[model samples]
Target: MKAFIVYCHPSENSFTRHIRDAFIQGVTDAGHECVISDLYRMDFQADMTEAEYLRDAHYRTTPDVAADVRAEQEKINASDAIVFIYPVFWSEAPAKLVGWFDRVWSYGFAYGDRTMKTLNKGLILCSAGNPIDYLEETGILDSMKKVMLGDRLTGRVKQAEFVVFDSTSRENPLREENWDKNLKAVYEKGKSLFAAK
Candidate 1:
């Protein structure tokens, strides 16, 4: 199966990057083709502008910018699964990643009428300040569920997995080994799900 991996982390040596890399490697080792969109590395713009919307509405898709948007949309359209790997800043996604959602997942591209209904899967791999239970108590996970699975992915993605790291560690918890464990768990789950009926 084809998996589109969207990673949003600024530092090259960040713990977030380490987790993302581990997930990518695991998915690749599982014999799946991976399309990676590294948001920070790409210098994506998080803010949405009315001007860009107008241009898109007019189909004034320039060769460079237009194709870039189309390229990401096409990848989403073709993928069987999507993996979102990023650090949870203030209990939400990084700014540029949010911008990615605003720009890349445009109307008639990421979603539309009943004409385009395809069941796919989405996996959210994120790191936060606390454990899943704590986050749930604070209603963080629910908000993300609505935003990630509800607003953005919608009916296009049926199955959704949330892999969260309890990062209240005194030091960096996203060490290579720890990140590998998380990725391995997610990868195994994916394999099992894929193998099922």
Candidate 2:
């Protein structure tokens, strides 16, 4: 089985990057092929142009998608599973990821007689500034799940998951304390990416 990871982060010196590295290592160790799209490193064009907006808004399927968008879609079709790794920003994924959806999930491919394949799983690994309990209490957790799993990844993936590594703010001591533990768990998660469901 193959896994495709979409990693988004502006800085290399980040816990999120650590999560990504550990997860990738685990996947490779499990003997499954892995492909990574580091959005920031690639300087991916996240914003939708006027032509793209017009094509999507009107639900037109004839126009050809941009090369970059086609490349992402190709990756999705090639993999058995998909993973998204990033940090939570304003109770949501970074804007780059959001825009990825806007452009990549085009009408012809993601909807309206799409060619994208149905994957075995979809997983989200995100770091948060606040604690998980606080996020749950504030309803941020559920909202994030609904948007990511219920909406964005819905129908596209056979299974979907949203994971949050909370209390990762620089000021929080738990960031350091839980760092190893969280990475261990996510690495295991990666190892099982192709395990029987």
- Strongest candidate by lDDT: 2
Candidate 2 Cα outliers beyond 4 Å, as residue runs: none
lDDT of 1 by residue, 1-116 (tens): 88888989887766666667666666677677778898878776766577767755665543224556667777777788888988888778888888888777665555442223
Query: Taking the tens digit of each residue's C-alpha lDDT, what string does model 2 give over 52-141?
Result: 999999999858999999999999999999999999999999999999999999998989888888888999999999999999999999
Model 2 / residue 56 / CA error / Å: 0.6
Q: Worst 10-residue stretch by lDDT in candidate 2?
A: 188-197
Every candidate's lDDT: 0.71, 0.93
Instruction: After the best TM-score superposition of candidate 1, give how far the Cα of residue 32 lies from its true spot, in angstroms.
Output: 1.3
The best candidate by TM-score is 2
For candidate 2, give the lDDT of residue 63.
Answer: 82
In Å, residue 59's CA in model 1 sits off its true spot by 13
Please give the lDDT score at residue 130 for candidate 1: 65
RMSD of each: 3.7, 0.7
Estimate the lDDT of model 1: 0.71
Residue pairs in candidate 2 whose N, alpha carbon or C atoms collide under 3 angstroms: none
